[model samples]
Target chain A: MPAPAIQVDNLSKLYHIGASEQYHTFREAIIEVASAPLRRLRNFGRASSSDSNIIWALKDATFAVQPGEVVGVIGRNGSGKSTLLKILSRITEPTEGRAHMRGRVGSLLEVGTGFHPELTGRENIYLSGAILGMKRTEINRKFDEIVDFSGVKKFIDTPVKRYSSGMKVRLGFAVAAHLDPEILLIDEVLAVGDAEFQNKCLGKMDDVAKSGRTVLFVSHNMGAITDLCPRALLLTRGSLQADGSTPDVVSEYLSVATPDGYVDLRHWKSERSGDGPMRIEAVEILDSKGARAGQIQAGEPIRFRLSVRGKSGAKCNLSVAIRDMMERIIYNPNTSDDKATVTLPAERAIVEVSLQENRLARGDYSASVWLGDAMNVTNDRVHHCLKFRIEDSSLGQTRSKGLVRTNGQWSVQRRGL
Target chain B: MNPQSNQFTSAMTADESAPAAPSEDIPELIIEAQKGWIPIHFGDLWRYRELLYFLTWRDVKIRYKQTVFGFLWAFIQPFLKMIVFSVIFGGLAQMDSEGFPYPIFVFAGLLPWQFFSESLSRSSNSVVGSSSLVTKVYFPRLVIPLGAVGGCLVDFAISFLVLVGLMAWYGIAPRVGILMVGPLVVLTVIASLGAGTLISALNVAYRDFRYVVPFMVQIWMFLTPVIYSVDIIPEDWQWLLMLNPMAGIVDGYRSAILGKPFDWSNIAISAAVALVLFFVGAVVFRRIERRFADII
Candidate 1:
């Protein structure tokens, strides 16, 4: 029967692309201020207004959450996920509409927001605690608890500049975890910590949710979203796409993920280094049917199609290396390794690297390509140029012990028993 | 301070006993941001006073952490400046000190001047220096510059001791009216905070303010009566010089520590001008605070 902890009403935000950019000098300020009236008159005269450069980062976003509800927000890049959190945290003002919260709110848009390297770890805990809006007395009450959680008791009195990066993050997350705000807002800062620390952070978040506080968590990690949140909100192009149970919303989000989970690199605009005679313009991952695959299932055959352009008489052989999320190369297929070379005929050639079966475990992977001649002459090379994911299947464990899965046969003879 | 601690404890107790209050009666904070000026929220500033103190402490702690001289560096700046000015202006140019020893006279004037300039330059950069906190979290943004200004008061305190030493070395004895130093220090801080707040806010939008501020401070020092006595100026134009808040403050310091008659009229004018600057700075700072996280 209680009211919702957070209520948002038609919230929106607009960002000017270029025309409304900042003036960074007094000269620029004077010029702009002097011409302001003329500019307004010109804007008024332009009936068609062809030069409108404003983009709505968020549009009419309305949502409400009951007290103690842990909600997850999921979206692609440029989907206004960050803008929404910024508005809620009051980091930036909303252009229109409003949101209401009924209790003390602590937003961890970033961990270690105000940590000074010269301060000791103990001092930084109090300093960061205050920056996150915790009172001195409250920090006093939980000082030991935070230190104990970070497991940096021995180094507590040492300056944080001396602490390892992992130690600093652990200490930072510990301080944030101990914050007892009635409403906690978190961004993707948890992704910075190692796996064990991330697990501890998630566990602490679970406890916080159970302790009857409201939480709005934003992350690109779908696994974490589904694991921690019972309800999820999906944002696409600044509008709420769906809001429902975690599974339903996640499924909805995944359904809209690039068809077959394959990235099309034909439009890849990142700079590549190579000899001017040859260029690899497009790369893609294709399934058995040659369909663009964003994700490939275990035990399925997959192919990488590299579209290359080269000058006449340019001798180039293609190679690709598949790397896991940690950038550890799982496998590499190289024509030079096989003592073979394919010279460019006239202008363009499509190089195909197909795997009989993708035995990769459930994790994200990226493919990089190189072009060289038979003399081991390097023509062009790109690192982690394309990305894709491997999904779990019946053949492999849900989580693999290593990067790749080998279908090695095992049979037990009766004589052993 | 007592009330803040009491509120902290009560808030803690309230958290421990949460879900006990009638849920229907819980207060809701509506956050509809409109584009316009908002009143100065003194309540929010009071609520975040602890943060202000901590930020000031952080500044002070970080300044001397790895330095060899530590707090002695504060004493060295004004002391060295006094020596340099005495050699050039008092020794070479033979500027009159109006009965006080030239070294002690300049030291007295430099004490307040150094504090004002140091506080002004530091607080002007405070907001931009703490941009990470400004862009990520929401508190009274005014706390940043105010806390930075507070931090410089430590340096002032350190340098004030050097002034006392010089006074003793010159055989100048303190008088009962020296109590006025407290009010003079407060006035200097208010003026610094006011101007610093305005500059910091403008620096958020136009980064040129960064380059402008240092040059402005350098010129500002010459305008203040740090190297010479105010009596050097024509009598009628003396009031015109007091328009610079630091001029009156430096004069008051010399009068107070040297047991000279206090310039009550000029001090009154300086205090009024400082107060006006404080209000104007507050208005400008508050007007731009909401947009700092975005613009910065």
Candidate 2:
């Protein structure tokens, strides 16, 4: 019965807002203060000052984590993820409920939290370490390692304001990493660094997890979350939506977040909304069976099925895009040679464009469909309507590392004199 | 494994109690072990008193760093005000200082008022000014204003020493009542913190506190008997004005620094109001402290 690393129960936070309901002038304030109870009694039948501005950031959120368990928290924006973290971290008190945590909790909610512009990077390391709840000896023991890890050795003695943004973020992260707290709550801090730096951070976090310290990681990057955390809790619109395996939750999240690649913009929530009658009806990625979904490899065989229609039966040039999660187009299939014309029957038409092998790395990507009139007759239409996910594993279900193990040929040769 | 690893015995006990967390161990159970100890606790504030000291020190250092005249800024403002008051009131208005030199009368009043005004200005905007720290991490929200208010003591000391210099040049000696300077100084600090905390908390919710502060401080200056003696007011009306907490504190400062009588009746009223203000300010601050992270 190892004591659980963290326990939270029946937590709820309620915020009361103010309306124009004024609290009397000075003379009236004195009289109101004297008769507050009487006033309340008189106006008990109706709400007076507050016009129902009570918002609950969390509602009965109860969960616990064991020691050394690295759990990913998956949630949409405003899903109470940040609020839960804040309350647990004690940035603010839970409106109702108690959280019992064992050991110091180090949080990287934001980088460079306490760096004074006038203080040197070296001084800031100690200052931030202390703020993170590390003692002097604790910081002293790991000071050199933190500096080395941050790769800011050259700028360690320079004032923090003088350091580059990367240098500042690195120093802030390094101090947080070396804190050695029993529990760590990190909010996508690795997001600050470059790809190589991010890779290095992932490796370090892997080591942190292996060291048997409990960690709660929150990130919108499903790849990072799925790679690092085995278990995850998903929140939607402020309630616990799903609590299960990382792959399961992420897959669930992606399905719900499937951008309104649907043909009609009104029925669908389109990412790109704009002028005139131009809107994406639907975007479908089908398999050889013509099923709505096709299991995809990063850069392998796949098909794009677009269903777009214009207000009139006129022919329209089609433009399709394959954008990665960061919104960079990984593949675009709207060139002249491979183009297909669907004399859209007035209101609706289906266009299917299939490639022998879809070349993409294993991850989530969005399928975009756009429509314009023939001979440059109308405005351009670009909309991300449907969501597509590339599974690295033939297992197709496991979200293991967000990265797939691609088969590449390699050989070693030696030259002898 | 090391021979003393407690490997065999520890493993056996692990079944009964969590090994990493020593549920039965007195020290291990100090903070709750679930979800990692609540990221913060009210008790933690008491534990981290040294951090508060260092933060206050940081504020003082940061304020003085890279400035041209360094600590002299503390003395320069009050000294300038003292001369201006002495010239205008002592020379032109010819207001009596109860026989003591006019500058001495005015400087003693200005000294506490200046500390009050400076501390209030800094503390009122302290949370908003440090928005970088407030919204992201959790520390006692009280620390920002406390540090800003506490940092003023350094400036107060620097300027207070100048008063001794001015008194020496004037060849005036203080009476034994100077011992009351310590309590009077404390009273002044309490008055400013009470006002600053309440205002700063409100400042976060309504950004209008930014516009209101300098305007309020400007008006507050006249309400207190800084430029003139409280004796200038007819005796009957003095008690009514003493409701402004600084009135008693500023008057008390003049009493201790100069040889004036301790105005106990007025001070008693100010003490009651100051204490009430502090309690009121603290209540307002605590109630709003939780919302700052979300709203601010």
Candidate 3:
């Protein structure tokens, strides 16, 4: 057999919490180094043991993908998915072990990563393409096609700052999608743009996968993963928990649970997009009786309690979406649907949404919460941050056929009596 | 360039053919944890030369984007500095210009000195300023500071025109030794890049370098013979001044442009010091670069 396109062997990365922490000034670094000797003497035993400030972001992750294989990496926030991709792309060095790639590699850790605002769209394409490791000739050859795909031809010469955010995302994804590398690593960049553009990106990615190049994709969107990848790897915490067919790996991922019935959104590390005057602090799932429950019957009432923390007198529109294991929205409840404006009285407040009856099919599900303003600007969003299970109704345990159970009333009427 | 084009063509062909096509032309990449003091990878730098070009181009383009004066600012800055120094040092202080007019002499020194200082300050902050690129994309980290330094060459070229005009006005003709200015300018770049790369890495590790760099650049200017001729220093102590790489560079520019006798010993010492700084800078940058994406 030909050599695998990518081979990762026991790759690990240890992050120092306080040592390389952000916002550290030179004076603090100097003082820390100066006091190192005395501090070490005082905590000699603790120093020799395990330092509390150190945490492994990735540990002993070993996997290999053959040429032309498309593999999806699925994980919760801080599950080392991005860390793994970062290491493979060589954005950040691994702390231990190594990885080998057989051919040229291109990674899209972020879209529009190096696009200078002052540059025109055409110039940004060249600049961003070069940043992503594309040769100038290659970009020249694909320039027309990229512009056509992005649908930003009218603004090609306009400065990028003038383009809408959606336009920017489309242009960015178009450039990345044209990168004809032997190996491609993508990290949740498809989570931007409108649905039509996202579909176009997925179609382009499909074409890329069909071209026989190896691909490693990371995304929180399970539906996209199932659509694009045949095989998948599941990461829990920092370890590779499962690697198998997409179905099995996704099921394994969905079954991984948070403690109790609440997820602490305050410190959760997920791909969050928004400027925040309002933030989601935590989310709690409750059954009909209002007690914390990890699983509810298909017909039982479910309530989502969202603890929002923000500035006093801030106004927001809160929305919650329940999605199935495939990441398809099974149910959506929005405060704006009732024309309700949620006003914050103080620093923290709990806003709860109750479903009178959960008609979701018997399967694993996750809740994504969103906070936005009247201007349609997303103030904060946490996607699929809360996971729970829905069981069959108490009458009989029958597997459902689709994403939701039909609750239509049955009325028999004879048309030709 | 030939090999790279060949690789690209082969990669394209491989993409079009069957998956199992036995083309062994594809290069293998191995990424391992870097230990202490990793050696510089000149090959990687060469391969990423296009990115260096684009980054430098981006800097130049964005620099004067909204400015009304645009590229004229490049000429105006050095010319204004020359006038101010000519009045303050040449007229008020009566500092010695050796032989040439004070404006021409000081302008000669200012040319290399301005390039050095501008490139140094920009490059020292380049890694921190491009934190988005550093943390997201993977290229030779050396390219960031190198591109910053490269971008300053445009301003230097523009300001060089002013110096040329001044020389013509003064009716001072350049000799064949004027070709030496090219090597001296290169030496200045080396010195600036060395210091820039070192400070940029430090800036990433300690943000306080944000305040330290400009202050350091101010102090560094006084130490170099920019406003005055090196002859002002005592004969024995003049050797000590050459230890500062910019001193020799400024002296070399004046010697080349003014057609003065070259100081071979001073130039030699300056070249040696510049090389040493470059070596140290590259080593430290490479050693610390592995952590840049993490810390930055």
**Estimated TM-score per prediction?**
0.84, 0.75, 0.83
C-alpha lDDT of candidate 2 relative to the true structure: 0.74
lDDT (Cα, 0-100) at A213 in candidate 3: 87
Higher-ranked by TM-score: 1 or 3: 1
Report per-candidate DockQ. 0.55, 0.24, 0.53
Candidate 1 per-residue C-alpha lDDT over A1-417 given as tens digits, one digit per residue, 9 for 90 to 100: 788889999999887655346445667778989998888888885664534556678889999999999999987656788899899888888889999988878999887878889899999999999999988887888887688779889999999999999999999998988887778899887777778888888877777777788999998777788888999999987899999999999777765644453444445433244554577777778887888887888767989888788876677788889876444678898887766577777687877788986788876666788876656566677765666777876565565575577766899877864
DockQ, ranked from best to worst: 1, 3, 2
The list of candidate 3 runs beyond 4 A from truth reads A46-50, A258-284, A289-300, A304-386, A389-417, B1-24
Task: State which candidate has the highest TM-score.
Answer: 1
For model 3, which pairs clash? none
DockQ value of candidate 1: 0.55
Model 2, B256: alpha-carbon shift in Å? 1.3
Regions of candidate 2 where Cα sits further than 4 Å from its true position: A10-60, A93-98, A136-142, A221-227, A245-360, A366-386, A391-417, B1-42
Arrange candidates by lDDT, highest first: which order? 3, 1, 2
Model 2 Cα lDDT, one tens digit per residue, B1-296: 24353244334434523554554332232221133222334575776665666677778878878889887888888999999999998899998788888999899889999999998999999988877778778777777787888899778988999999988988878899899889988888888888888888877766777888999999999999998888889999999889999999899988888877898999999989998997787777777676677667
Write down the worst ten-residue block by lDDT for model 3 chain A.
A44-53
What is the per-residue lDDT of model 2 for residues A1-417, given as tens digits with 9 covering 90 to 100? 787878878777665543322222334446657899997988898778554456576777888899889999976555678878877787766767777788767777987778898998888887777666766666776787688778889988888999888888888887887655678888877777777777878877887787678999988677788888999988765677788899998888787655332333446532343344544456667665556563555555677766665665766667678776555676677634455544567666666777766556677766666665565333445455556777664645443443234445899899788
